[model samples]
Target: MDKINALGALGALAQESRLDVFRLLVKAGDNGLPAGEIAAHLNVRQNTMSTHLGILTRAGLIRRRREGRVIRYAADFNGMRGLIGFLMRDCCGGVPEIVRPLAEDFSNA
Candidate 1:
Protein backbone atom coordinates (compact mmCIF):
# COMPACT_ATOMS: atom_id res chain seq x y z
CA MET A 1 0.00 0.00 0.00
CA ASP A 2 1.26 3.41 -0.98
CA LYS A 3 1.12 6.27 1.50
CA ILE A 4 -1.97 7.76 -0.09
CA ASN A 5 -3.93 4.52 0.03
CA ALA A 6 -2.77 3.81 3.54
CA LEU A 7 -3.79 7.25 4.64
CA GLY A 8 -7.18 6.81 3.04
CA ALA A 9 -7.80 3.58 4.93
CA LEU A 10 -6.61 5.15 8.14
CA GLY A 11 -8.85 8.14 7.65
CA ALA A 12 -11.86 5.94 6.99
CA LEU A 13 -11.22 4.05 10.21
CA ALA A 14 -10.62 7.21 12.22
CA GLN A 15 -14.34 7.52 12.81
CA GLU A 16 -15.85 5.53 15.69
CA SER A 17 -18.76 4.04 13.76
CA ARG A 18 -16.63 3.11 10.77
CA LEU A 19 -14.04 1.50 13.01
CA ASP A 20 -16.70 -0.50 14.81
CA VAL A 21 -18.21 -1.59 11.51
CA PHE A 22 -14.87 -2.71 10.10
CA ARG A 23 -13.90 -4.58 13.28
CA LEU A 24 -17.28 -6.27 13.36
CA LEU A 25 -16.94 -7.35 9.75
CA VAL A 26 -13.46 -8.68 10.40
CA LYS A 27 -14.75 -10.73 13.32
CA ALA A 28 -17.59 -12.02 11.17
CA GLY A 29 -14.96 -13.65 8.93
CA ASP A 30 -15.40 -14.86 5.34
CA ASN A 31 -19.18 -15.29 5.56
CA GLY A 32 -19.62 -11.59 6.44
CA LEU A 33 -22.97 -10.03 7.26
CA PRO A 34 -25.75 -8.23 5.45
CA ALA A 35 -25.82 -4.43 5.69
CA GLY A 36 -29.05 -4.38 7.64
CA GLU A 37 -27.79 -7.00 10.05
CA ILE A 38 -24.61 -5.04 10.56
CA ALA A 39 -26.56 -1.89 11.23
CA ALA A 40 -28.80 -3.65 13.69
CA HIS A 41 -25.89 -5.22 15.50
CA LEU A 42 -24.14 -1.90 15.83
CA ASN A 43 -27.31 -0.05 16.77
CA VAL A 44 -26.80 2.37 13.94
CA ARG A 45 -29.41 3.67 11.57
CA GLN A 46 -29.60 1.75 8.30
CA ASN A 47 -29.03 4.81 6.10
CA THR A 48 -26.15 5.98 8.24
CA MET A 49 -24.57 2.53 8.15
CA SER A 50 -24.92 2.53 4.38
CA THR A 51 -22.93 5.74 4.17
CA HIS A 52 -20.19 4.37 6.43
CA LEU A 53 -20.02 1.19 4.34
CA GLY A 54 -19.59 3.23 1.17
CA ILE A 55 -16.67 5.13 2.67
CA LEU A 56 -15.00 1.91 3.85
CA THR A 57 -15.44 0.33 0.40
CA ARG A 58 -13.90 3.34 -1.33
CA ALA A 59 -10.99 3.23 1.11
CA GLY A 60 -10.41 -0.45 0.29
CA LEU A 61 -10.97 -1.46 3.90
CA ILE A 62 -14.17 -3.40 3.24
CA ARG A 63 -15.86 -5.25 0.39
CA ARG A 64 -19.50 -5.39 -0.59
CA ARG A 65 -21.36 -8.26 -2.24
CA ARG A 66 -24.94 -8.53 -3.37
CA GLU A 67 -26.85 -11.61 -2.36
CA GLY A 68 -30.34 -11.51 -3.80
CA ARG A 69 -31.81 -8.21 -2.59
CA VAL A 70 -29.32 -7.81 0.25
CA ILE A 71 -25.81 -6.44 0.31
CA ARG A 72 -23.23 -8.11 2.52
CA TYR A 73 -19.98 -6.54 3.71
CA ALA A 74 -16.68 -8.09 4.69
CA ALA A 75 -13.26 -6.83 5.61
CA ASP A 76 -10.86 -6.87 2.68
CA PHE A 77 -8.10 -8.84 4.35
CA ASN A 78 -5.57 -8.10 1.64
CA GLY A 79 -6.13 -4.42 2.02
CA MET A 80 -5.81 -4.75 5.80
CA ARG A 81 -2.58 -6.67 5.40
CA GLY A 82 -1.25 -4.02 3.06
CA LEU A 83 -2.02 -1.27 5.53
CA ILE A 84 -0.31 -3.20 8.35
CA GLY A 85 2.68 -3.85 6.11
CA PHE A 86 2.95 -0.17 5.33
CA LEU A 87 2.92 0.71 9.02
CA MET A 88 5.48 -1.93 9.98
CA ARG A 89 7.69 -1.57 6.90
CA ASP A 90 10.45 -0.05 9.00
CA CYS A 91 9.74 -1.59 12.35
CA CYS A 92 12.30 -0.81 15.09
CA GLY A 93 14.70 0.41 12.39
CA GLY A 94 15.47 -3.18 11.34
CA VAL A 95 15.72 -4.52 14.88
CA PRO A 96 14.07 -7.94 14.97
CA GLU A 97 13.84 -8.09 18.74
CA ILE A 98 11.65 -5.02 18.92
CA VAL A 99 9.31 -6.31 16.24
CA ARG A 100 9.29 -9.92 17.35
CA PRO A 101 6.63 -9.48 20.01
CA LEU A 102 4.21 -7.79 17.62
CA ALA A 103 4.72 -10.55 15.06
CA GLU A 104 4.10 -13.12 17.76
CA ASP A 105 0.83 -11.41 18.67
CA PHE A 106 -0.38 -11.73 15.12
CA SER A 107 0.69 -15.35 14.97
CA ASN A 108 -1.25 -16.09 18.11
CA ALA A 109 -4.29 -14.45 16.59
Candidate 2:
Protein backbone atom coordinates (compact mmCIF):
# COMPACT_ATOMS: atom_id res chain seq x y z
CA MET A 1 0.00 0.00 0.00
CA ASP A 2 0.99 3.65 -0.37
CA LYS A 3 2.09 5.79 2.56
CA ILE A 4 -1.27 7.48 2.95
CA ASN A 5 -3.16 4.18 2.94
CA ALA A 6 -0.69 2.64 5.35
CA LEU A 7 -1.05 5.59 7.69
CA GLY A 8 -4.80 5.31 7.59
CA ALA A 9 -4.73 1.60 8.42
CA LEU A 10 -2.33 2.19 11.30
CA GLY A 11 -4.45 5.02 12.64
CA ALA A 12 -7.57 2.89 12.53
CA LEU A 13 -5.88 0.14 14.49
CA ALA A 14 -4.48 2.62 17.00
CA GLN A 15 -7.79 2.89 18.83
CA GLU A 16 -8.50 0.40 21.63
CA SER A 17 -11.88 -0.80 20.40
CA ARG A 18 -10.76 -0.92 16.81
CA LEU A 19 -7.65 -2.85 17.72
CA ASP A 20 -9.65 -5.39 19.69
CA VAL A 21 -12.14 -5.73 16.89
CA PHE A 22 -9.43 -6.23 14.30
CA ARG A 23 -7.64 -8.86 16.40
CA LEU A 24 -10.89 -10.70 16.94
CA LEU A 25 -11.55 -10.70 13.22
CA VAL A 26 -8.05 -11.97 12.56
CA LYS A 27 -8.62 -14.83 14.97
CA ALA A 28 -11.92 -15.53 13.24
CA GLY A 29 -9.94 -16.14 10.04
CA ASP A 30 -11.16 -16.06 6.41
CA ASN A 31 -14.67 -17.17 7.32
CA GLY A 32 -15.06 -13.80 9.07
CA LEU A 33 -17.82 -12.74 11.47
CA PRO A 34 -21.08 -10.95 11.07
CA ALA A 35 -21.46 -7.50 12.61
CA GLY A 36 -24.00 -8.72 15.15
CA GLU A 37 -21.84 -11.65 16.18
CA ILE A 38 -18.84 -9.37 16.54
CA ALA A 39 -20.81 -6.93 18.68
CA ALA A 40 -22.07 -9.69 20.92
CA HIS A 41 -18.62 -11.16 21.35
CA LEU A 42 -17.08 -7.77 22.10
CA ASN A 43 -20.03 -6.60 24.20
CA VAL A 44 -20.48 -3.60 21.94
CA ARG A 45 -23.67 -2.17 20.51
CA GLN A 46 -24.59 -2.91 16.92
CA ASN A 47 -24.28 0.69 15.77
CA THR A 48 -20.94 1.08 17.50
CA MET A 49 -19.62 -2.08 15.92
CA SER A 50 -20.86 -0.93 12.58
CA THR A 51 -18.92 2.31 12.93
CA HIS A 52 -15.71 0.55 13.86
CA LEU A 53 -16.05 -1.92 10.99
CA GLY A 54 -16.79 0.95 8.66
CA ILE A 55 -13.59 2.74 9.61
CA LEU A 56 -11.50 -0.40 9.17
CA THR A 57 -13.12 -1.10 5.83
CA ARG A 58 -12.50 2.45 4.67
CA ALA A 59 -8.86 2.14 5.67
CA GLY A 60 -8.62 -1.12 3.69
CA LEU A 61 -7.79 -3.14 6.78
CA ILE A 62 -11.03 -5.12 6.53
CA ARG A 63 -13.49 -6.18 3.82
CA ARG A 64 -17.25 -6.34 4.04
CA ARG A 65 -19.55 -8.77 2.30
CA ARG A 66 -23.28 -9.19 2.49
CA GLU A 67 -24.76 -12.59 3.15
CA GLY A 68 -28.50 -12.39 3.08
CA ARG A 69 -29.29 -9.70 5.65
CA VAL A 70 -26.00 -10.07 7.48
CA ILE A 71 -22.83 -8.18 6.70
CA ARG A 72 -19.68 -10.12 7.46
CA TYR A 73 -16.23 -8.59 7.87
CA ALA A 74 -12.85 -10.13 7.25
CA ALA A 75 -9.30 -8.83 7.52
CA ASP A 76 -7.64 -7.98 4.23
CA PHE A 77 -4.57 -10.18 4.40
CA ASN A 78 -2.89 -8.44 1.43
CA GLY A 79 -3.33 -5.07 3.03
CA MET A 80 -1.97 -6.47 6.29
CA ARG A 81 1.06 -7.83 4.44
CA GLY A 82 1.56 -4.47 2.79
CA LEU A 83 1.51 -2.75 6.16
CA ILE A 84 4.09 -5.16 7.58
CA GLY A 85 6.19 -4.79 4.47
CA PHE A 86 6.12 -1.03 4.82
CA LEU A 87 7.28 -1.28 8.42
CA MET A 88 10.13 -3.69 7.66
CA ARG A 89 11.12 -2.53 4.19
CA ASP A 90 14.48 -1.17 5.44
CA CYS A 91 15.01 -4.06 7.88
CA CYS A 92 16.59 -1.82 10.57
CA GLY A 93 19.66 -0.96 8.46
CA GLY A 94 19.76 -4.32 6.68
CA VAL A 95 20.21 -6.24 9.95
CA PRO A 96 17.80 -9.17 9.80
CA GLU A 97 18.74 -10.06 13.37
CA ILE A 98 17.16 -6.84 14.50
CA VAL A 99 13.73 -8.44 14.03
CA ARG A 100 14.41 -12.08 13.37
CA PRO A 101 12.16 -13.36 16.14
CA LEU A 102 9.27 -11.17 15.09
CA ALA A 103 9.79 -12.06 11.44
CA GLU A 104 9.77 -15.74 12.29
CA ASP A 105 6.41 -15.43 13.98
CA PHE A 106 5.06 -13.35 11.12
CA SER A 107 5.99 -16.13 8.71
CA ASN A 108 3.14 -18.21 10.13
CA ALA A 109 0.90 -15.18 10.02
Candidate 3:
Protein backbone atom coordinates (compact mmCIF):
# COMPACT_ATOMS: atom_id res chain seq x y z
CA MET A 1 0.00 0.00 0.00
CA ASP A 2 1.10 3.58 -0.54
CA LYS A 3 2.18 5.59 2.49
CA ILE A 4 -0.80 7.94 2.28
CA ASN A 5 -3.27 5.07 2.29
CA ALA A 6 -1.43 3.33 5.07
CA LEU A 7 -1.38 6.50 7.13
CA GLY A 8 -5.09 6.97 6.64
CA ALA A 9 -5.84 3.43 7.73
CA LEU A 10 -3.58 3.79 10.73
CA GLY A 11 -5.14 7.09 11.69
CA ALA A 12 -8.62 5.63 11.54
CA LEU A 13 -7.62 2.73 13.74
CA ALA A 14 -5.93 5.07 16.19
CA GLN A 15 -9.29 5.80 17.77
CA GLU A 16 -10.39 3.46 20.57
CA SER A 17 -13.90 2.77 19.34
CA ARG A 18 -12.85 2.27 15.71
CA LEU A 19 -10.02 -0.06 16.68
CA ASP A 20 -12.32 -2.10 18.89
CA VAL A 21 -14.93 -2.31 16.17
CA PHE A 22 -12.38 -3.47 13.60
CA ARG A 23 -10.95 -6.12 15.90
CA LEU A 24 -14.46 -7.33 16.69
CA LEU A 25 -15.27 -7.61 13.01
CA VAL A 26 -12.04 -9.46 12.33
CA LYS A 27 -12.84 -11.94 15.09
CA ALA A 28 -16.34 -12.32 13.66
CA GLY A 29 -14.64 -13.70 10.51
CA ASP A 30 -15.84 -13.50 6.91
CA ASN A 31 -19.50 -13.99 7.85
CA GLY A 32 -19.33 -10.73 9.78
CA LEU A 33 -22.21 -9.16 11.73
CA PRO A 34 -25.10 -6.85 11.16
CA ALA A 35 -25.05 -3.28 12.46
CA GLY A 36 -27.49 -3.99 15.23
CA GLU A 37 -25.67 -7.10 16.27
CA ILE A 38 -22.37 -5.25 16.37
CA ALA A 39 -23.86 -2.50 18.51
CA ALA A 40 -25.34 -5.00 20.92
CA HIS A 41 -22.13 -6.97 21.13
CA LEU A 42 -20.11 -3.88 21.87
CA ASN A 43 -22.69 -2.33 24.18
CA VAL A 44 -22.70 0.78 22.02
CA ARG A 45 -25.65 2.78 20.80
CA GLN A 46 -26.75 2.18 17.24
CA ASN A 47 -25.82 5.69 16.15
CA THR A 48 -22.40 5.50 17.77
CA MET A 49 -21.76 2.16 16.09
CA SER A 50 -22.75 3.66 12.79
CA THR A 51 -20.18 6.40 13.20
CA HIS A 52 -17.43 3.93 14.02
CA LEU A 53 -18.34 1.71 11.09
CA GLY A 54 -18.31 4.71 8.78
CA ILE A 55 -14.79 5.64 9.83
CA LEU A 56 -13.54 2.09 9.37
CA THR A 57 -15.21 1.74 6.00
CA ARG A 58 -13.87 5.08 4.79
CA ALA A 59 -10.38 4.04 5.85
CA GLY A 60 -10.78 0.86 3.80
CA LEU A 61 -10.37 -1.32 6.86
CA ILE A 62 -13.91 -2.65 6.67
CA ARG A 63 -16.78 -3.15 4.25
CA ARG A 64 -20.50 -2.76 4.56
CA ARG A 65 -23.31 -4.38 2.61
CA ARG A 66 -27.04 -4.22 2.75
CA GLU A 67 -28.87 -7.42 3.64
CA GLY A 68 -32.56 -6.73 3.39
CA ARG A 69 -33.04 -3.71 5.67
CA VAL A 70 -29.89 -4.33 7.67
CA ILE A 71 -26.32 -3.34 6.97
CA ARG A 72 -23.78 -6.07 7.63
CA TYR A 73 -20.17 -5.18 8.10
CA ALA A 74 -16.97 -7.16 7.74
CA ALA A 75 -13.29 -6.50 8.00
CA ASP A 76 -11.52 -5.98 4.71
CA PHE A 77 -9.05 -8.83 4.75
CA ASN A 78 -7.14 -7.50 1.75
CA GLY A 79 -6.71 -4.17 3.48
CA MET A 80 -5.45 -5.92 6.59
CA ARG A 81 -2.98 -7.97 4.56
CA GLY A 82 -1.77 -4.84 2.84
CA LEU A 83 -1.18 -3.14 6.16
CA ILE A 84 0.78 -6.13 7.42
CA GLY A 85 2.79 -6.25 4.24
CA PHE A 86 3.63 -2.57 4.53
CA LEU A 87 4.86 -3.04 8.07
CA MET A 88 7.10 -5.94 7.14
CA ARG A 89 8.04 -4.82 3.65
CA ASP A 90 11.59 -4.21 4.76
CA CYS A 91 11.71 -6.68 7.61
CA CYS A 92 14.98 -7.44 9.42
CA GLY A 93 17.12 -5.06 7.35
CA GLY A 94 19.02 -8.24 6.31
CA VAL A 95 18.66 -10.12 9.63
CA PRO A 96 15.84 -12.66 9.47
CA GLU A 97 15.86 -13.28 13.23
CA ILE A 98 14.33 -9.88 13.84
CA VAL A 99 11.05 -10.95 12.32
CA ARG A 100 10.87 -14.54 13.50
CA PRO A 101 8.31 -13.82 16.20
CA LEU A 102 6.01 -12.05 13.74
CA ALA A 103 6.22 -15.02 11.38
CA GLU A 104 5.47 -17.33 14.27
CA ASP A 105 2.45 -15.23 15.25
CA PHE A 106 1.08 -15.47 11.73
CA SER A 107 1.66 -19.20 11.71
CA ASN A 108 -0.09 -19.66 15.02
CA ALA A 109 -3.00 -17.53 13.93
TM-scores for every predicted model: 0.94, 0.90, 0.90
C-alpha-based local distance difference test score of model 1: 0.95
Ten-residue stretch with the least lDDT total in model 2: 90-99
Question: Could you give me the TM-score of model 3 versus the true structure?
Answer: 0.90
Tens-digit lDDT track for model 2 on 1-109?
A: 7789889999999999899999998899998999999999999999998899999999888998999998999888888888988888877786878778779988787
Which residue pairs clash in candidate 3?
A: none
Top candidate (lDDT): 1
Total backbone collisions for each predicted model: 0, 0, 0
> How accurate locally is residue 9 in candidate 1, as Cα lDDT from 0 to 100?
98
lDDT (0 to 1) per candidate: 0.95, 0.90, 0.90
lDDT (Cα) of model 3: 0.90
Q: Which of candidates 1 and 3 reaches a greater TM-score?
A: 1
How big is the positional error of residue 89 in model 3, measured in Å on the Cα after superposition? 0.7
TM-score of model number 2: 0.90
Model 3 ranges with Cα > 4 A deviation? 94-97, 107-109
